[model samples]
Target chain A: MHNLEAILAMGLVTLLCRATPFIFFMKRKPPAVLDFVQRYIPPMIMTILVLNSFKGLRFGLAPFGLPEIASALAVAALQLWRRNALISIVGGTGLYMLLIRVL
Target chain B: MHSNSEAPRVKVLGPAFTASIPVLLGYSTIGIAFGLLVVKAGLPWFLSPVMSIVIYAGAAQFMAIALLAAGTDIVQMAILTLVINARHMVYGLSLLDRFAVCRRWKGYLIYALTDETYGLLTTVSPPEGARSESFYAAVSALDESYWVAGSLVGAVIGGLVPTEYTKGLDFALTALFVVLLVEQIRSIRRIEPYAIATAATVLAFVLFGPANLLVIAILASIAGILAFRRRLP
Candidate 1:
């Protein structure tokens, strides 16, 4: 029941979410201050997200563990190697899962 | 700028509908994962779509599911959702350029300024002398259509599939992030983002416990950015 509700609700929200921005800003470009803010903001937000998503403080050999840290490294390498979003995801997640179970 | 007085409306609408195909495919995968998570969290599957429509934030939606599962209060859920998605405030900032033109549509744009759409728009500057609003509208519609379709597909699958198979589906979010970050790193000549992310992540894990690490990460990254601002250009 919950799944069903989530599916329907999320579907509409997703549509509206995608639509609202264009609907509002389709006619204009952001100001200089906004451009500046956009430039610097994502790094901070992403940093916070990555830190909070971690499972543990200490892992096998170092502070970073096999799951997230390894995945992060994989993402960086793959991005440098391929420059493709889908490929990096597959490589990073696949490697992370395999490492968690194997090592 | 080509005005509606000269250009046909269908000309603008056609591209928006067509571009949604790829967006739809990506949304489907994530939507399915979300559907599965909501169900696993023991919330009514039907209600998931409602929240998805209203809140419309991917990360926040997932967080909402977790909160709902834990029986979190409604007020707490709302506040947390707002905090987690505060990044959208920046997204809004970027849209100000295009948004100022469509005075009547401001309300809807504020509602729909999502991460994916923002990613697509901010990176792609419109051609000069073109009617940007039409193009923007098309992209926005395409993105929304994809998301809606994805959620619907997820719900249908959730209704049919067994619970065990869906257990591992929540991974789509992390996988998506990994992919996006990788893309960012690929084109990024400035290593500051990488350095900041790494240093902040390490410092956060060390000084603060995992729970408080998010705040530390934000601080460290900001500090890094401030320190290196002169080198950005």
Candidate 2:
């Protein structure tokens, strides 16, 4: 019951967050802040999300986040070269999986 | 007449499916990991799919495993979920223009806007003849199905697969983000947001630790953008 309650609460909270903008701005003109966020924040948030993915890395350790850095660079490079999302993701993830095992 | 009505819907489906392929890969892999983690954490296997269907947020669902294990209270869990998912509000803000035309599917679109779905929607343009709302709905529903299916598979076979083989499969999520970030960079064609976000993330990590990294970094980045708005292109 407790687990169920927690799940429901989390779900409600998440839906609320996702819905907040639509609820507020559905009928009115969104403020200038909306334009600012829409214009500049997508890339900013994406960059942060990409960086946050490395939160578990141990930078001070022996490998020193090398696998993550190398794999991310591979993904970015592949994406830049081929412009295919699947190829870049699969190639990068495959390389990371191999690197983690061997390194 | 029926074929005429159906033609553009068919056209939208193709591009929507193509755009969602990366998310299919990423969500399935990560969803499986979440299921495995849930079972490994000694929670009932059913909760994995339940959470996937209900919460539908990847990081928050993962965090819920730890929270449940620690016996965290419901209110606290809800609060943390809001904080963790706060970036989604920004996603909603960015999507206003795109979703403005989606009156019929607006509610479902809002509910299904996971990180990967949001990325795909923001980056991929609807085909010329198809309705944008229909395209958005297709991508969102397809992504959610992939997630639920993956989680169910993982839950059913939770203990069967050896942990070693699945070690870095979660990297697919990061790779997805990197691909999306590259797309964002390409379209935006500006360095300020990227630089500001990176700086803010580093600052947040160093100052507040990883526990509060995302929200703090997002707040700082928003502030940074506002401060430098005049100079930005």
Tell me the DockQ of each model, to 2 decimals: 0.21, 0.78
Q: Which stretches of candidate 1 lie over 4 Å from their true place?
A: A1-37, A42-103, B1-27, B37-43, B66-72, B98-109, B124-143, B162-188, B205-216, B229-232
Per-residue lDDT of B122-217 in model 1, one digit per residue for the tens? 544444444666667667767765666556656656566554533423343454444445445445556787788678878767776565454456
- Report the C-alpha lDDT of model 1 over A3-94, residue by residue, as the tens digit: 44443444444444345445554567545544554575554454444445554436556424756677767766776787655566567666
lDDT of each: 0.58, 0.88
Can you write out model 2's per-residue Cα lDDT over B1-233, one digit (the tens) per residue? 66675777778878888888777777777778789889989999999999999999988999999999888999999999999998788889889888887788899999999877887788777889788888999999999999998888788895676768877877887898999899998899888899999999999999999996888998899999998878875
Chain B TM-scores across candidates: 0.70, 0.91
Give me the runs in candidate 2 sitting further than 4 Å from their true place. Answer: B1-5, B69-71
In model 2, the clashing pairs are none
**Candidate 2's error at B134, in angstroms?**
1.7
Q: What TM-score would each prediction reach against the true structure?
A: 0.62, 0.93
Estimate, for each residue in A10-72, the C-alpha lDDT of model 2 and write its tens digit.
Answer: 999999999998888878999876687678867887899899999989989978999999999
